[model samples]
Target: MAQTTELTIGYFTVIFDEHTGWTGGLLVLNRGGRPVEFQCTLPVRPSRAHEILFGTTLRDHLIGEVIGPILIKKCRTPLSMVCCDQAESLSLSASGGVPVALVGEAAENDEGPITNDMLVGASRVKLAGATLHVPIEHTETVEGIAGRFVDLVDAVEPFERIREAIKEAQSQISRAS
Candidate 1:
């Protein structure tokens, strides 16, 4: 909801490019009313919480452009998911409790091991309403991982959370006014 009051939104997105490695990012939509934009680095991976966020500043190269795109391609297969959110601890059902690693789309069919470590990678990003919880996971094959990433795009929906948070933030801004 776009009101006079400003708001912010935290959204999770997965990107896939056959030519390059699959990458994901957390988006912060600043609706603060003032035109000032807010752009911050995502410190953690969404599916595999333990893994460090992609930290290279490649904003000037083709690979960098591939890393974050406005539109993402879709996939037809299922990818392993690790819920990463500082808001909640991850609890998987496998031994070692390591999150399930995701495979790429171009690889031969094989369901990777699911861990009790819970695919929950614990990284959080705050935006419009509430903090977006995300974890990161990667597979041996980039193709499989990219494919799984596509599945992620299809699954783990969070638009409603964003909308609610934006509304709440706007109300708070209005009150302040």
Candidate 2:
């Protein structure tokens, strides 16, 4: 499998505003970082009752359990792995039916040097100088897929494109309204 080349990666993120609620976007990119497909959801905001009910778990529930899976399901392209910027979105790995990685800043407060095992529970991986944490069971799969693209593209750069696309989508939505 390592000898096989080329893989598609799905970058997913959700943007929220008081008025817009939650807007989710998924950008599917080829090994070269060119977009193959893009999907975004209509904004969904929790009601005041829902906000209170969910409490501290609201964001995770909305972004991970709800928005994340919806975007993944709506994507047409088969993704080798899905990468998300928010840790809450990591929950997608549990039911996304594909490997999911949470990309973010490094944890600097660890008691000692960070080893793959320490991070592996979260299926953490380093690619293009970014740290990504995946589901423990999918660690090997995410790593293998990421390995193919590390040399061909900066794994973290496509995320910028995803963000830009999300902003563009938000503006379009606003204009439409």
Candidate 3:
């Protein structure tokens, strides 16, 4: 099979409900923010024993280690970078072998630390609008990917789509049961 070099980005998020422990969805989009592929995992409700064993790290482990990789691996389209809203999901970078980042609003104080911020689009754009948290090693990769679509795609928009998709998926699952 021929390898595809299209610039694709993956957005991942997990929603947790009292009944459903964690339901994660990964939405793959082209540079223009068009949906390429989407994969959602079955709800994973960790047992009480597992929660006790994991302690405070339960969410990070469940979302990052367990759910995130499964969704990412199932994606048929090749992704250049994976963007997530949760810091816990940043761990997907290491496990999934793709540059992962946490997208959020930048800090108000410009004098603060810029060490971890991933600037999207033009350098002239206000830095306080959106920032991405990526591993130190993957900084360049994430920046390069973000730069390409900075003008075309809003960094925070795809996440909203993922959230809506998860809700839709959950409703379907609920209706079936």
TM-score of each: 0.21, 0.82, 0.82
Report the C-alpha lDDT of model 2 over 118-174, residue by residue, as the tens digit: 444674677767878777788888788877775545666666676688788888877
Which ranges of candidate 2 are over 4 A from the true structure? 1-6, 106-120
Model 3: per-residue lDDT, tens digit, 1-177?
A: 223569988888887888776889888877777787888888899998998999888887988899998998778889898877776787787788898877655212224533334333312221114667667688777777777775544767776787788888888988998
The alpha-carbon lDDT assigned to residue 39 of candidate 3 equals 85
Global CA lDDT computed for model 3:
0.73
Model 1, 1-177: lDDT tens per residue? Answer: 232222222332333333323334433333221212222222222233222343232211212233222211121112123222211112221322223222111111113433324335633332222223334432233223223232233222343343344445445755996
Q: Candidates 1 and 3: which is better by TM-score?
A: 3
List the RMSD of every prediction in angstroms.
17.5, 5.4, 5.8
Itemize residue pairs with steric clashes in candidate 3.
none
Which candidate number maximizes lDDT? 2
Residue 69, candidate 1: alpha-carbon lDDT: 27
User: lDDT of each structure?
Assistant: 0.28, 0.75, 0.73
TM-score, cand. 3: 0.82
lDDT-best of 1 and 3? 3
Determine which window of 10 residues in candidate 3 has minimal summed lDDT: 119-128
